[model samples]
Target: MKQTTCRIRCVNALVLAGVIATTLAACSADPGATPTTEPTTAESTSPIDRFLTPTESVPPTAYPSATNSEQVANNVVSWYESGGEEQITGVRDRSKEIYSHHAEDNWSIDFSLFFDRSKEAQEYPPIPDRKTQAAWSTALKHVRSGASDIYMSNQLGIVRGSKEVKREAHGWKELAQGVKGLKAIEARLHREFGLDPLTSP
Candidate 1:
């Protein structure tokens, strides 16, 4: 009876050991069964990733297009006669608003080239006569000067107050005269050259 009881005790110990081995093998085979700790703050977030992501930026305005002299002259006349006037007036109307941030951006892009006499000659076709050429030159200078005054006034933060107000009004007056001068010059050149004016779109 004692021998039988001892054999039975050994068998029971072996069965218990086998059960433990099976459980260990199952855990090893299925790693996903184990619970994982949450990631540390440093692992979950990175300053470089947060701040270095690429972002869209504003593009520079395209320069006005004109390949030849006649085209350049026509472009200048069209811009001054219509586009420039509309842009300046729009900006003036919106000067008191928050959304007028880029009010003076168009001046340099559209009109600056005409102010450079050498550049103007190189880019534009020759006017038919000395008289018309003189008129053209004067008109460009006036327009450039007037535009500069307006641009500078905005740049210098002279938007309000009585003195600055008067200065801005004066600038507007000069700009109007410049526009009128440009119109007259355009007409003379068109008549002299027999070139048709570009129709406003």
Candidate 2:
């Protein structure tokens, strides 16, 4: 009976030795190595960086929309007659205010002569295609031959500045002398360029 007990103990010792040896081999095979299943090329990017890869821009430039207010304003006047250019030039003289702000984190943006100009659009070479026409681009246009009123949109609703050969801004709601034609301009701006006529300055 003593010999049988001795034999059972010897078998148990051999099984324990095998388990320790297998565990040690597995741990040493890849010391400090990352798991093979994880991805190595994963990355992250911010909202602004996406503009770098865009292929489309207003006026079709590889660079940003307008270098400065003067360039855009001048380009607009080129589409107008000499007398109209001189008149439109006077109002746009105020450092060329362009509206480009988006509020409440919404995709749609409001533009206004009441709102000051922002050069934020200049930073990017190619801006990402927007959901609507840029407000500043619409604001810059004037008739090459006919008359156009210099209108400003603010919280008080649409306001007309001037329509006659001479332009002037007298007050917020009322100014200038011409047909209601400027209203159509504002309407077209809102429709094509996302200018919320109701948006405040």
Candidate 3:
């Protein structure tokens, strides 16, 4: 009986890991893929609330579809690059559609210096500084995925922050200065994680 229980437990753990690996893999397909959302007017139909509050936590057994989350994030990024943040509350179109999509899963985004979903998480780690943010490749759960400074910079194409920005020398510029898209990221975060795809703003 004891041997059976141990076997079952190990099997269960492996199954769980496989499920997560599958979800993450599916989401990560075609990293360079473009947004599927058709372009529309930049006007936003999203209420201010979606960006402000955290999404209701799902049960641990309720795994998220990384693919869908990735799509939503991609659409929002397209909208943002075209100035979606500046064009809030206007005629509705592609921007509005994508924005609406994002609001549906705002947690998947990382707002960086713009929002504070970090405080909203039920089980989150302490806020990390610039150095730490750049190092962590895994997405943050409580905040969705869009809260880190380095994470968003990579999404916006300002810096090559595809992963951790490593260094310890003196001549390095401040994180804010190096990443021009940072302020835009932060402000939009004020507007909005998953997977820009890690969350800290």
Which ranges in model 2 have alpha carbons more than 4 Å from their true place? 30-201
Reference-based lDDT, each prediction: 0.50, 0.34, 0.35
lDDT, candidate 1, equals 0.50
lDDT string for model 3 (17-120, tens) is: 99999888877796866666775444343444345436332223222333564554554444433333232211112112222333253424323322332222
Output the worst ten-in-a-row residue range by lDDT, candidate 3: 87-96
lDDT of 2: 0.34
Please give the RMSD to the true structure for each candidate, in Å: 17.9, 16.8, 26.5
For residue 166, model 1's alpha carbon misses the true position, in angstroms, by 3.1
| Residue 21, model 3: Cα distance from true site in angstroms | 0.5
For model 1, state the Cα shift of residue 132 in Å.
0.9
Over the stretch 1-201, how does candidate 1's per-residue lDDT look in tens digits?
A: 999999999999999999999999988887678555887776797555565435422221233565766765665445434333333333222221211223444323333333343233324543434465566556555555555555566554445567655664565565565556656754654564444344321
10 residues in a row with least lDDT, candidate 2: 171-180
Better of 1 and 3 by TM-score: 1
Off by over 4 Å in 3: 31-201
